[model samples]
Target: MASSGTPSLLQRVSGSMVVFLGLLSVLTSVRCDEQVPVIMWTSEGISLPRQPPPTAGHIVGHQQLASYLEKALNIGPRNVVLFLQDKMSIEDFTMYGGAFGNKQDGVFPNLEEALQSSSSSLVLPAVSWPASNAVIGQLQDQLETSPLYMDPETLSQLRLNASSPALLVFRLPYGTGSDLLSAKEILSGNDEVIGQVMSIMKSQSVPYTAIYTGLQPSRKEAASLSVEAGLGGGRSLLQARGTHRDRWRDRERQQRVKEKPGVYPPVEFKEDDRTCMLLWAKGLTVSILRNNRWEEHDLTPSTFGEGVSPKLHGSNCDKSKGRLVLNYENVLGHRSFKLIFVMSERHYKVSARRWFTLDAVELEYDGTKARFNGSRNIYAPAEYSYRCKSVTSFRWPLLIPRSSKDPANQWRVSFDDFQIQGFNLKGSEFSYASDCAGFFSPGIWMGLLTSLLMVLVLTYGLHMIMQLLTMDRFDDPKGPGISVPQTE
Candidate 1:
């Protein structure tokens, strides 16, 4: 009886402890679902800390914009994710950001999708972006003077999530030609819309949709912004030389050739327009095939610097063939870094005619090979350059995909935000160059000089040989003319 009674008492205590733990878990889960406030702004939009209001429609200086953003990011305990909207033009943005079906219709849809899918407390609906001045002021007033509330269940749900204040800022647009617009012009207005966005954020509820700016960046600005966003632009081949090609002149020349052409034989190498690629590598070996032979370029602080590039100017890759094979190998354990392919044409309006098909593209290093089946048809917005109402020029990354499971083969590159698909490799071995060169013809100037020197030396050597082989001989020496005597 005593033993049985002791066992019964022990079971009772254990059961009580179990009940206590289960109750504690329920309370903990309740706490976990609570939501936190977030502030998201598109690159097409801008946000300023509440202060004495400034003149309406007044463009904010770029320095002021950058300073405000930096302060917002560092000042509070909040989460910030900057949506680099103007980083890439509309077409490129779709190609890069649309793979996951995040972008639909236009820029705002993309932003809304991202916010909806995130764990943030609020979602801002898409509206006419770059809203009028009156709209901006009204939105700002509400955000600054609103008392936001959350329901009990919604608040309970927030308990399971981490809460923090967040601020997001977008990049400014770049215009074309001498009409270059300042960052202030693009990022300045729409304050009221931004304020309304803040109010929605404070509301701690799901927004119906996101605001749309409909303000697509120009081609030139897109390129400049891409580099600024760390997506593609870097020390370009043009920048390396401190000189640039005159696109207008090149365009006129091409037009003349085309007008009187019989299958305009793939524009000769001397006449090829500028197309380039940027490569980043340190202590690596890079080579390009010229005349069916590999020409090596070493990457170092002196020759190729920390990054090197080989600009494809019609010679390295035959224009008639429309394909190029770039060979790379890793030596001395220096791995490759990043590569960006830039394509440009004259006139933002004439950008449609340029196209190249990358076929059977392969990168082999460290006994591992990655193959990409490239084609001109694969690039999005299948419209011709001339037919394109908007600018048609853009840049793309040339790197191995990080994962094999990417949808639509579009993989977001980690080295920079540049997106690419199709090329995937698991091994690292090839070393790449960081310097950009226009003419990839191996041994260019050196080869020319060497050949000339060889010809001169050969000519002199032959003359000496001929003089030695033929001699004027006579049986008797004539004092007037000294000549070699023959033993005959």
Candidate 2:
């Protein structure tokens, strides 16, 4: 009886545990389905609808939202509405109390009241959010603003029409309790709540801009949501969250390029109408060691001319020997760099190809210099042999030491689409430059020989198998062979 009672007791405990876990899961799921509040203000009044909240991942970015509004509102292509999304934290409000005011939750309502009191013209409060105030002030001051949100065309159209654009502000609830609807659901134009909001805007019949300011979903949540939805676009939600750093880097690179004066003019060496050698580059940049990191500085003709004009010379025009000298100044502060290219023609008997090589590259920076010597062949077809035949990263590191404290402080040079033409007699287009001695090195030849030997062995084995005849002595057993008459 004791043993039976023990088994029964254990069974009851296990069942109860399962029941508790099931209930806990159900409650957790219910909590995740929290509702989000969406408010839209129009000339008529304000409308807040009770609808299911959108999942955090499905939220469309500011640009996509603006595009949708433009089409639905029938705003002309020239006219535009400036959309801004501001993310704020509790600490920001506390730290910038003077700029944001004491009431954090009432910030959106305050903006609405201010807009309502104003006439057709949209008048932002002087003490509103930092981003909002700065944009409005820039517009009022006629300063340069990003054309992505506010372009000159849009502003000009507004001035011509003499009509004020409407301003809509949305204050999203903070925290994970409520989730924003996905872009798909909102764009479908089927959601009751979204449709009602659009209806309100259409009824106003005025060009409008919207501002969504509040705490955004956490990075982890946004990334996961973006993955689950499989969004793809130049400005998809995934890219906004995942590739934010990449975008920032690209922008920085563009800014640096803009600061560059220009590119080097194309230089050609001609021998009796037949051009012997031609050199040009889309852009040239040098990497200098600054603050223990490498930073790129552009080298252009303007800077080069300031010191010594670039020189092009050659012994003959038969794609044999040539030299190029480039001198520049003020590349990085008072520092400057010079590059010399030694060119020579080489023939490959194995490949039956004629190409030119960058025999050596001499780099001089500041008072230090280094020279890299070797046969760096240019590989390309006979037609386009004027270019580098081999693909190179185009970044060559110089051993010149910049810092006495650190031996790793070295300079480097990079070329963007550097092209050399007229190296070959029949060459019309640019070819590639080889950074290596030859395409077929000893190791590569060894690989080719081994593969050939394997193929020969395989062929011999197949031949032997084919030569062998089937045995006619297949078991004299069986019975006597039965013969039939050919006529029958």
Candidate 3:
């Protein structure tokens, strides 16, 4: 269909295409920085009633120790660099830079490689004073301010541009460091740092743990500080600044944490597989029971949450004579576990108000189970259904059991859902951070359920009416007409 006047396209390949190819050959390339292996120790001064921590406690000391050694012994400075102290070079003293270089002097690569060979940087600087207006003025004149410190308030913001696989170093300064390092007199102004530190640590990662150390004037001086001050062993001995020896010990513990399979709790699960439970004041017995049996279980949830599930597990005991007790440790909410019990030989009349005991592991009452779902629900999965309920503890509806003449019937009383939560740090998998679909507001869910129920009822009623109408319209003239039956 081409017109005769059209030119042959093959002969007219655009000269513009040729020009474009030439520009493609001239494109430039840029290189990205190579990442390096490192350990960054973030430091902060912990706030107790007294002053600050010594070396952010021992754990971080260990991490610093490991990073220190890795930089020294790794046989390559290009491999690992502790970014905190610019002067640090496989040392055990001073700041991380070469300050403690003697610790790794002979062990690590040459001094130059350790310094210049770093293709990447890892920071592990201990925190001193909050880089507040006061402290910033002091540091700004000396060392270059770290990017995190660009914002003057960053130090006050305890949780800032933090690094990962990161060690948070909390300070427990003795009176000396404060007087020596701090710009303020009495350093009482720095107390805000402690309050900020605690507020942030609680909601951070499970791997996120704290190490607290202190440096103080003297033992009696610290003891005089008082219990409300948050001192340990109630003395000033623990509140003193760490010397060189303290650093070494901290390093030792840290090395074990790394080389050894499980030293302390990292973000990962460790040997203890420790599971912490938030128990309530009412569940002292339950806490005692759990503590006694701690080793037997991997991680027992010592706390109860808002709602109880339909299926429940665990054991409870009724210590009080007429009172029904439910074990909840630090757990706030009314919903507790259900008790499942079998019928005994006696045909006792069970009252909903009366207390009965159900013993799974411990003893608790059956009817005593609180409705956690009224305002909140305590969620329990299927695996924890064993202690869901026990009957001997609480007064529940009575079910007739076999008499002496009859065979024994193995009966089970179940509390379908008992509201409780435990530390399941297995990451996702129904652990601390569950991806399970969330429930709607109780009122909203109730409305939805009611609407669906009404729909079903209406459909059922309409079906019956339609059938009756059909029968009436097609009734057999010779036979009796179909009659409506009472709806049950």
Which predicted model would earn the best lDDT? 2
State each model's CA lDDT, in order. 0.29, 0.37, 0.25
TM-score of each: 0.21, 0.28, 0.18
Candidate 3 C-alpha lDDT tens digits along 1-488 = 01111223212323212111111112121000111112221112211121111221112232333333333222221111111211111111121112222434222122222222222212222321111101211211122221121111343454433232222233322233434333222222222343354334434422222212121112233223322222112233243323465456546645665675522311111112122221212122121123344211111233232222112212111222111222222222212222222111112355323222211221221111111111011223312211222212122422222222111122222232222222322321223322123457557898999999999999999999888743335667899987668895
Tell me the alpha-carbon RMSD of every candidate: 25.8, 29.4, 29.5
Error of 1 at 112 (Å): 22
Ranking by lDDT: 2, 1, 3
Candidate 1 deviation (Cα RMSD): 25.8
Model 2 / residue 417 / CA error / Å:
2.1
Alpha carbon lDDT at 471, candidate 3 = 30
In model 1, where do residues sit more than 4 Å from their true spots? 1-57, 61-64, 77-251, 256-397, 400-488
The total of clashing pairs for model 3 equals 96
lDDT string for model 1 (405-459, tens) is: 2111221211211111111111111112112123644469889989999999999
For the record, the alpha-carbon RMSD of candidate 2 to the native fold, in angstroms, is: 29.4
